[model samples]
Target: MANSPQAKKRARQNERRFAVNKARRSRIRTFLRKVEEAIASGDQAAAAAAVTEAQPELMRGVTKGVFHKNTAARKMSRFAARVKAMGS
Candidate 1:
């Protein structure tokens, strides 16, 4: 349906961007899942390490426009708190 050349170009660009963003989102989710699994296993040390690894990925998602700043901050805060509480 992109009759104009500009529109066709934009559609192509969107497809490429969509693929990149999807990969980024999947990578972030994988990191988050690792943290969740570590937490569920009740291994505080492993959870902490996983959280440490995930923090930057989440922030990177925010910087890359995949996630909102506050959303990433909130996730980090909650995960950190949970990891800390696991030690107690």
Candidate 2:
């Protein structure tokens, strides 16, 4: 219960930020899903393209504070490795 006005305002702000962050996270997941599907299909070209498209989105999430830098970096590294392995 937010009794103080300031607390109430903060609660409101948190709710708004939560919504925004949730949407952003969902969008990032969608991009990741595209990459996963491309990879699973065993289409090297599509997987490569998906990774290219997702790279910037993942970094954008990191820049926007939606995801931690290391988390995004690790995901990108793994995805890149998987894509590379698919080629060879």
Candidate 3:
């Protein structure tokens, strides 16, 4: 369907971008799952560490346009609150 050369190039670029974004999303999810698992296990220290590690990864996702800024912020806020609540 891409008759024009430019369009064909764009389609190819889109495929590459899609793969890169997919990998980034998968990596981000892996970090998120680590935090969730740590939190579920009720290991405060591990949960705290996991969240700390995930925070940067989430922000990186936003910077790379994989996630919206507020989405990452909300996730970080919720995770932080939960980790803090575990203190008591």
Candidate 4:
């Protein structure tokens, strides 16, 4: 489909970027899952720590263009709220 040389090169670049971004997204989800597991177990401290670790990874996803800035913020905000609510 990419008849032009430039288009072919761009397609190749897109494929590589897609693979890298896919891995990054998976890694971010793994970090978030750790937080969710901690929260589910009712370990507030561990949940808080896990969220702290995940915060940067999620933000990194936004910076890397894998996630929107507002999306990442909303996720972090909701997770933090849940972790806070777990206090009592």
Model 3 misplaced stretches (Cα beyond 4 Å) = none
Model 1 TM-score, 2 decimals? 0.97
lDDT tens per residue, model 4, 56-82: 999999999999999999999999999
Runs in model 4 with CA error above 4 Å? none
Candidate 2 Cα deviation (angstroms), residue 28? 0.3
- Give the lDDT ranking, best first: 3, 4, 2, 1
Q: State TM-scores per candidate.
A: 0.97, 0.98, 0.97, 0.98
Tell me how many residue pairs clash in candidate 2: 0
Minimum summed lDDT over a 10-residue window in model 4 is located at 79-88
| Clashing residue pairs, backbone N/CA/C < 3 A, model 1 | none
Please provide, for model 3 over 1-88, each residue's C-alpha lDDT reduced to its tens digit, 9 standing for 90 to 100. Answer: 8999999999999999999999999999999999999999999999999999999999999999999999999999999999999999
Query: In model 1, which runs have C-alpha deviations exceeding 4 angstroms?
Result: none
Which candidate wins on lDDT? 3
In terms of lDDT, the poorest run of 10 residues in model 3 is 1-10
The deviation in Å at residue 14 for candidate 4 is 0.5
What is the Å distance of residue 56 in model 1 from its true position? 0.9
